[model samples]
Target: MSRAIRSAPSAAAPTFAALALAAGAVVAVLLGVYGSVHQPTGRTLTTLGFSSLISMKVWLAVVAGMLALAQAATAAWMYGLVGGSKSAPRFVGPLHRATGALAVLVTLPVAFSCLWSLGFQSYDTRVVVHSVVGCLLYGALVTKVLVLHGRPTPGWLLPAAGGAVLTALVLVVMTSAVWYLGTQGVPTSTGY
Candidate 1:
């Protein structure tokens, strides 16, 4: 007679991590709500050497959105999700992280200015899309960070979160910054 070998039971579920993710998501959504309802202060924070703060914001948004695209591309290459080499170089991972961090840094001032000076105004179609994307962008970023730090989430989770962040950032740039630059003209408005 032969006896079957049994594997040990797995450790307890990561309840704390799950809870943290939930809390982060909630906080992000609440922030979006607050931004939406809050009235915009007419005054804007200026960037040194830039014609106006809005111009700086536009330039930063473009750079951040481009970096986000690069992140997505590198991630795809790493995962072999695109038509390219079956594996990405080891440097790709570090590059992705560095680009993402830089993108976040670049966007911080732009986000602060948008929320502080414009709230979530929607006086036109572009503005409406921009407002909605802005809300989603913060939420997506929070979710992406949570998943990045969370314990062993599903394989699809990280890519999905990253994709969402990229999409939202692109939409925000297209609808607001790019549109403003193309139609209304750059540095559309000046100091308070």
Candidate 2:
């Protein structure tokens, strides 16, 4: 009988995941620093026939939140957390990708507008919370993407990163869009 030997698992995967997470943290910190130091342009954007820039941002954030919710659902389905099946349906993967892409697309304009016009305001508690979490949202997103693309990562890493992204996104939406809707109500008219 021959003796069997098993090699130790490679350490590179965890190291890569750590490095990616660190890079994401750096990106987030840089964004926050830039937002803090740079003077706001106070310039507002008009788009999609919104009555005001704030209204536009509010709506866009709402859209992004909805898309994020869809992303979460699809992710759960893919992982078989929601569905009873051992394997996800093929459509779930595409739907997840599509919703994730759409969420990013819908969020970009709002993020640009915020950084350009607001520049990480800190006058009020809500503003401060919103500004900080806004930066974290991007950071979490970066980490999630990096972990996803970097193969051989720890099985738990991707889900952890994704959960962080989702949490940050929910906070951002709650602090901004939900607050706006509560105080100002929905915009009835569009610029178009």
Provide the overall lDDT of each model, using Cα atoms, as 2-decimal numbers: 0.73, 0.81
TM-score of each: 0.83, 0.89
Give the CA lDDT, 0 to 100, for residue 7 in model 1: 21
Ten consecutive residues with minimal summed lDDT in candidate 2?
1-10
**Global local distance difference test of model 1:** 0.73
Cα lDDT tens digits for candidate 2, 153-172: 77777778888888888899
lDDT of 2 at 7: 21
Question: Which one wins on lDDT?
Answer: 2
Q: After superposition, how far is residue 56 of candidate 2 from its true place, in Å?
A: 1.3
What digit string (tens of lDDT, one per residue) describes model 1 on residues 106-161? 88888788888888776888787787777777778887787676555545556677
Top of the candidates by TM-score: 2
Off by over 4 Å in 2: 1-9, 45-49, 188-192
Residue pairs clashing, model 2: 49-190, 49-191, 49-192, 50-191
